[model samples]
Target: MPLTGRNFLYLLIASGIYFLSARFAVLLFSLEPGNIALIWLPSGIGLLMVLRFGYWAVPFIVVASYLANSAGMAAVLSELAWLHTSTAALSNGLESALAATLMRRLLPEGLQSFQDIFPFVFGVCLVSTAVNSTILVVNLVMAGFFAVESSWMIWLILIVTNSLGILLLIPLAQAVLQAWESRLQMRLGDAARCIALFIICTGMTWLAFDMFAGFIFLIMPALMFLAVQGRKESVYVTLTVTVGLTVALAAENYGPFQLQTDEWSRLYLLSYLYSLIVLVLGTELYQRDLLSEVQARQSWQYRAHHDALTSLGNRSLFIPLLENEMKRAERMNRAFALALIDLDNFKSFNDSFGHALGDKVLKEFAQLVRKNLRDIDVAARMGGDEFAILFPETPMSEARHAVERLRKQVEKLTIKYHGRTIQFTISSGLAEFIPHEKHTSDAILGRVDQLLYEAKRQGRNQVQA
Candidate 1:
């Protein structure tokens, strides 16, 4: 909220944008009775500024609202114009600040899930807009701008128009802001596809509003497709464009909502637009939540089963796989092999070169194992410096040859860490699972451990079967 150089710059930009949007809305969508725009986009702009810059934006909103309103009303009201314009500006600023404050308190996470929609619509949008509308209408009646009897209708119109402005514009602006801050990069094809979908949706929206009302329903599917397939920013932009076009066309009496009265038509149009936004955008948010949940669950499962250092299966995953493979070999009347491998003098190596190099050696060794093994083979890191492998449907001779090849590769593997050339070798024990042997995983593993110890005794960097 402090008026630093950056804050001052942002305030200037926000005020400029708010004033321009206000002028544009009044020029295009203003109704006769009170000169109120059917879609008051400056309300949204004010709210966004307040949300982003906190209470520092309130005075700028007031100044921008005063400038925009006073320009239009100065000729008619003359001296009393200052009072009316000042009241309107104060009301607009208050609405934005209050709405932003409520949103920060009630929806701290900011419209992330389906549960957020109701609170945002009712608590922030309706509540704040209603306050602004009430204050503005009361001020107008006091200033002889409208009859006391018509204050209720004018107030309702203001609420609907301002609420719709916030509802439509906030999401679009937020999406664009997020994309900008993240520097989101899209492939050329994907960007093209998104632009194409947006254009198609925009065209369809024009047809729906300008030509036939029945086409309105058809536009939703295109928007839905855009929501599902395109980026979040694109989807919000498409929705905003369609809604803007609908309002513009309706203001000119071109849409299907050209009913008995402009007020009724506006109400009908607002209803349709509100439902359209909620259904499409709500669905998109729900889908995003579901995807995030699924990804988090998958990441949790992967971390649970895999070694964080080597990305190989851990004991938890490897033991079950080994047991399953043993059962499969027995059921199919086939033979398989298991190997237990350990790095020679790993503790002393770690003491000499530190765990950083030790970790590099382990990762390199895991990669080597994966490279030498077949698709059907299973490899895992069984805690520090020890690894296990299951060679399914393989004979003892073939398994020994595979282990020997792996041992030789580990010997040749060199890790350059901190300009130090570090080389490590592995000692492994290979055991075979024959059909009808009825051997358990623990029994096989125990025999393999003994062979591993034997290999270590004979001399390191050897495979003892």
Candidate 2:
């Protein structure tokens, strides 16, 4: 979400779409038909646009509001209606602008995920909606257009409508946009099946809403089906069908909510709010659990491939890495070197100092290898006192110098063990991998092992190349 001239254009277009949709919804669901919408969407659109673009988009709110109000008024009243409604529309523009500004001031950092939606819903939504509603009521009544006795009722209606719009519309829009960005191409069959399912569900919902309101319960299977599928498009489509049907049915007073005409608005409002919350939270948590499972699996895989004591790559990981490096080197026709390191007098030292100190020596030696080698090099614990290092793109001469420096670093190391300072030395064997003179990983490994044995035989604390 960055700001550009093109982004400003998109925001303006989006504001128009949101304004038109809100006007349409209002016409359908207005308690006093043809005058005002029970739910006004401009507030939500304003906040959302500000979040997506930047503060510059706030002026679009004024234009959308002015046009929406002017058009709505022109359809019923004379041109003079614009004179009165313009002031009201100004409040709306200010309402939306205030909502967006408050949201920014309140959530400067913004939400990290849907999981962090509560505080935002509470603090910013409530306060901003209150500001917008109050400004609107005061603005209209002061202009002598709005009546005084019904002011409280209008205030309450505005609050509920604005809050519902913010809560339901923002996340729904987000899910749809996310699906679009995922670049998932639908196959012919997939598209057909999804559309067919949507039509069937819509038909069922229509029947339930028009005739047997209890049949609305039948949509639950489809609802759960879409939710469990866990695709953003699926979720957004399901919400569209469900919300569309509910609004249409409730508007006609032909649904389950018709049983109590006076309570339909409040009850349906709460129901929509609750339904969207459940759908959004369920989708987010389900995806989070899947991600957690993947991360946990990766953690176990890492532990499986690493030496537990030294926290270095063990035989399992090291061998494959070496093989892969060899293949890559061969492909590029580059040279690399491998060094096998064995701790000198390690067996006798462990016998004298106990296995605990022996584990310490192994860990310390791994750290020394890391500190000595270039970032391009790979180091691993072959096991116990044995280790290996791969120096990518290094010649035999460079490898020898690097290994000698590591040997010197190891020789200078000191460890405190139970009131005593202890020290150890390592003997290393080096071999350079030549691309033209190719060999299997096992052949290279076997040659390095032989050189390490020769180094040990010649007397410990020496490096053989």
Candidate 3:
């Protein structure tokens, strides 16, 4: 929708979801940042909200912050707390809005597919998160609200988690939306595969941590399998589940990438990067599938309008063109000509030799007829050994000249078939429509067809206008 009251309501609902989700993330994953949380989802979801709704939703980030911040609603009643929370919320909202803005400017296809994935990964994930984290940290330090001892750690955590949230989580949500709109169709088999793959990956992750620490890369193949075999939704669901389980396992000191450090930032960075692989590859697969579908559609359309043997416009495409030209010439008081071409003794070529050579002769003869025509002229294969040509805005003299020139070319043309040379000639009839002649396409074609038979009756190797 539009910028209406209902949209504001949607903004509120989205903000509420962001608030709750961010709070839940903080409660589960906290470090030395004093409840500042590692996986900062509010910012990522804020970006999604602005992209989904409009920039008008940015201010509601404050509402999300107030509801989710460790400092409760009562603390916000105080002047100092209110100022601090407002600053943080504004910083979050502005950075996310900046991400949406920069992505709009940078991504060529505007967040649609793999085409725009690079810009989002760089602009929204890395650059936007870095800006947000830096600003928030500097603000807290200047305001003396946060201790400066662990400022670097806080910044690093914010950057990685924020990037993870945007790259990993946002795509999951985007996939669901695409599936809802029927843009990305997910089959039951694909969903089943994704679930099974996730289970297998989780088990492997558990085993790798328990037995072989070096085998931590086991989830890669599973995710890659899902990305290759599934649609956008299945790839997204598989990645999300894998990330969640791996993070949970690593956080609890069960996974292999568990460096002995107090902050498990390595897992965050590595897991995010690996998940990045899945997202990009999955989107590329989707793009290829989409391109294949478009090509298939275009192929069908071409076959529908064109002759297979000659690769020329067929009857299905010719008549409408004639009608359009008729309408235009009638309206503008201009002139156009229509011609029908029939090759003499064409059946002898097929019967004496084979249909293959006859087809080759026909194709060559069609090309001969098409020689030296104006851009607005149309040539079509009416059927076996019969063709139609249309010349828009041409008078009878030029129309007759074009037909005679093509006939002479057909006379000289020769097709070589298996050490034998097949030679042929064409008989054609030309019909011109002046503005004064109020004729339909059928009437003109009928008259031209009669002229063609007349040329044949008069002895074949000639043109009659």
Candidate 4:
């Protein structure tokens, strides 16, 4: 399936939201969470890209990391802003791109479970963070942000904490967002239930706030709803909790419990950043996982009904299609036809030229029929040496013209076996199904089979109705 422009926009928006939330978390807490390192930063976004478009994670991670480092350096360090920005941007962008690529290379050949996520996060984000942070601190000293004498200590601390934080919090944030999204999807197509859940979850989050404790615990209950019911419920739960916390915190600051300037800044920025990043990355990953599931299912269905060798519709697929056409013809009082084509003297060709040559002939014959047939017409291999074509909404006269062309073209198929050129001709038996006049698809097909036998009897390389 094609990914639309809207899909790309959605992915971009989701990643942007997550990056903003990460920044918010830093600003509000005044103390950055230790676990941001664990959750996998842009990797979550990259994972989503791989899932949705299958090849977009590389660019998405690069841009996201670059933007994140640029913004973070500008906010936290004011002096030598350009120097910090350049160094940070390079570290961040390279780390994210490399992480995405590395994870993609190590990908398991199946859907991932909750258990698989932690290892992926550790390997990609945590490892990348360590390397990137080292480069960043080294650059900082080179650019004189810190003296060469003290840079080592600061670099070590920065690398350790940042790497650990990324590996921890980023994964949690991603998981929380995913849980919430699953809750939301469960209520899909039910506007009333969705809105109701939204209101209720919001109310609950509001009631759960305490003076010293943060609203972080609210993510737990919300995740429960998502796990049990799906994304629709999770969205309501997360939204309600986040909104309630925001309102509660904001209202308190203006009253007798007014917060200091730094505190207020921290409160708003912290929760906002954390929520945004987790939500966006989480939702994007969830959607991508859903897309992957759907694609796998469709692929399985296609494989089940198609010939493994040639990818042409197999007998299993063709039979039902033929039946459908027969029904349509009955309704319209029109006539359609089925053709049973056989390669003349196929056994002799197989014996003389070898089975490999016979197989080549079969594949070439299917290809020739594909070129000759219209999209509305379906051709399938019944088995070795036999093929069938079902012409929908076609009368006897039109069917004959189409089948004759196909027959002529197939006769021209040549194969090289054992360094010798071998050619073959085909015979076809065509029969028309006249709506209610023919009671069953089997009956019509049986008539075509008889016609095929008669053609073979009259001598190979002929079509008889």
Q: Enumerate clash totals for all models, in the order shown.
A: 0, 1, 0, 38
**How high is the lDDT of residue 159 in model 3?**
79
Per-residue accuracy of model 4 over 1-465 as CA lDDT, tens digit each: 255798778768866855664455344422322212212234344444554455554455555555666655566566776666665655655665565566656544322444344455467655766687688778777656566876565554444434433433434445556666666343355545545555545554455444333443554454444433444334433443454354344333422223465344434444443444345335535655776789999999999898977779888899888888877887888888889999999999778877877788888888888888998888998888889998887888899999888777766766777778788888999987877674776787888999999999999898998
Give the number of the best model, judged by lDDT: 1
Of 1 and 2, the candidate ranking higher by TM-score:
1
Alpha-carbon local distance difference test for all models: 0.86, 0.73, 0.75, 0.62
Positional deviation of 299 in candidate 1, in angstroms? 0.8
Of the candidates numbered 1 and 3, which has the greater lDDT value?
A: 1
Sequence-dependent TM-score of model 4: 0.51
In model 2, residue pairs whose N, Cα or C atoms come closer than 3 Å (at least 3 residues apart or on different chains), thus clashing, are 26-37
Which residue pairs of candidate 1 clash?
A: none
Give residue 359's lDDT in candidate 4 (0 to 100).
82
Residue 266, model 2: Cα distance from true site in angstroms: 5.3
Model 3 reaches what TM-score against the true structure? Answer: 0.61
C-alpha lDDT of residue 188 in model 1: 94
Off by over 4 Å in 1: 187-193, 327-334, 350-357, 414-422
lDDT per residue for candidate 2 within 198-272, as digits (tens), equals 666677778876677666666666656655544556655666556556666666664665535454454564465
Give one digit per residue, the lDDT tens place, for model 3 in 1-465.
377888888888998898887777766554432544545657668888888887887878766875576464234234466666777787788877887888667863445655566677777678888888898888777666557986887787777777766766677776688788876555688768878887877777678768886555777777777666667677766666656555555545535665566555554545555565545555555665687789999999999999998889999899999999988998999988889989999898889998888888987876666666777799999988899999999999999998898888878877778898778888989988888677888899999999999999999989999
* Ranked by TM-score, top first: 1, 3, 2, 4
Runs in model 3 lying further than 4 Å from the true structure: 31-36, 70-79, 112-115, 143-149, 183-188, 206-215, 264-465
